[model samples]
Target chain A: GAGVSQSPSNKVTEKGKDVELRCDPISGHTALYWYRQSLGQGLEFLIYFQGNSAPDKSGLPSDRFSAERTGGSVSTLTIQRTQQEDSAVYLCASSLTSGGAHETQYFGPGTRLLVL
Target chain B: AQSVSQHNHHVILSEAASLELGCNYSYGGTVNLFWYVQYPGQHLQLLLKYFSGDPLVKGIKGFEAEFIKSKFSFNLRKPSVQWSDTAEYFCAVRAYNNNDMRFGAGTRLTVKP
Candidate 1:
């Protein structure tokens, strides 16, 4: 089975430009999550989606950041007016389900975004 | 809000040496603990997790972690390390009922042969 996959392994964008990162979750996975990993920092939670329920947007850092999961399989994280601070690796993960103690998240290779 | 702390930023050890990485989380409610590892040029993968029962949990690659509720800690350990064990480890915590998971700053382990 193919693992979670992300598009554009690396992206370099100018500050104030918008960038979109895509993620394809594993087959049959009902829970998907997005995170940001900065140098010398921990993974920062960004957003999450579980089945047909509303997406959890509590982790989004600002209004410029948003995500959408269409048809319950693919997700795209959009960052508007990207900042230098937004330069980091964007990782996507998926699990069999959400809110279960036994669920373990499987991560993708991640898309490295560099804002100049 | 919940937060995780990883005591060591970087640790270097020789092959066959014992390994221990400290992790602690601050959360008022019941939580799930996990250790994730990232090898060079690879994606992050689960090492182990603790949800309920059996405070001690073993994971792949001879790794294990003990959950101490009293101290709010879940420290990862291995009896012996190999040169291939060199990688970055992250400690994560999530409330039993919450969807948000928090991660530590990560500890880099360097094992020499």
Candidate 2:
């Protein structure tokens, strides 16, 4: 089975510009999550969708950061007016179901976004 | 809210040497623990996970983790390591009642052949 996949393996953009990162989760995965990985921050959860509905959005750093999933398959994370601090690899993951403590998540290769 | 801490930032060892990486989480409730590994240029993959019943969980590539509830720790260990085992290991925890999962800063393990 194919694992999660992300688009635009590398992206370079100017500061204050907007960037959209795309993620395609595995087939039949009902839960999708987005995370940001940087040198020091490790991995920071951005947002998650459970069957097209996000139960929690608090993980998003700021209002400029938003994510949406359609058809319970593809998810897009949009960073409006991106800053230098937002430069990092954006990762996407998915599991078979949601809200299970024992669920194992499969990760994508990630999109490396560079804000210059 | 939950937080995870990886005590070791980096570890270096020779091939066939024993390995241990510490991971601690700050949460009082029941939690599920996991170890994930990322090889150079590869995506993160599950090493193992501990939910209940057994305190020791074995994962791929001769990796295993012990969940100690009394100490709030889940340490990953392996008796013998290979050069191919060099990678970044991340410890993660998810509370029983929460949908969100917390991850540690990760430990970089370099195995010298």
Candidate 3:
């Protein structure tokens, strides 16, 4: 079976620029998530989409960071006016169901974004 | 807001040596714990998880984690590690009621042959 996939494995952009990172979840998956992995900062949850709706988006750091999942299959995270602090590897993951005591998530190759 | 902590930043050991990585979460509610591993240039993969029942849960590659509710800890351990076990390990947690998940700063393990 095909696993989760992400595009543009690496991206380099200037400060104040906007960038969009894409994620394709596995077929039949209903839940999608985006995370940011920064140096010495661990994995920070960005957003989660159950189907095409995002019920919990409190993890988004700021208004400049937004994500949307279309048709409950693909998700895109857009960071507007990116800052040097936004430099990190963006990771995406998906699971079978939305709510579970323990839902195993499959991850995709992260997109390394460097804000210079 | 919930948070997770990985006390160790990096570790190095010889093959056949025992390994232990400490993890702690700052949530008191019912939670699910997991151990994820990322090999060199590879995506993250699930190692093990603990939801309920037995406090001691075993994972792939001879790895195991014990959940101590009293201490709010889930520490991963392995006996007689192999050089292939060298990688970055991350501990994650998800509450029982919400879909939000949190992960700790990963610990990089290097097992020499």
DockQ of each: 0.89, 0.68, 0.77
**TM-score of each predicted structure versus truth:** 0.99, 0.97, 0.97
Q: Note the Cα lDDT for every prediction shown.
A: 0.96, 0.91, 0.91
Residue range B1-113, candidate 1, lDDT tens digits: 89999999999999999999999999989999999999999999999998899999999999999999999999999999999999999999999878899999999999998
Docking class of 2: medium
lDDT of 2 at B92: 91
| lDDT tens digits by residue: candidate 3, A1-116 | 99999988999999999999999999999889899999887889988888756446888999999888888788899999999999999999999986664578999999999999
Give candidate 2's TM-score.
0.97
Interface RMSD of each: 0.8, 1.6, 1.3
Q: What residue pairs clash in candidate 3, if any at all?
A: none
Ranking by lDDT: 1, 3, 2
Candidate 1 per-residue lDDT, tens place, A1-116, comes to 89999998999999999999999999999999999999999999999999999999999999999999999999999999999999999999999978766698999999999999
Give me the candidate number with maximum TM-score.
Answer: 1
Per model, kept true contacts as a fraction are: 0.90, 0.62, 0.79
For candidate 2, lDDT tens digit of each residue in B1-113?
88999999999999999999999999999998889999999999999998887899999988999999999999999999999999999999988857678999999999999
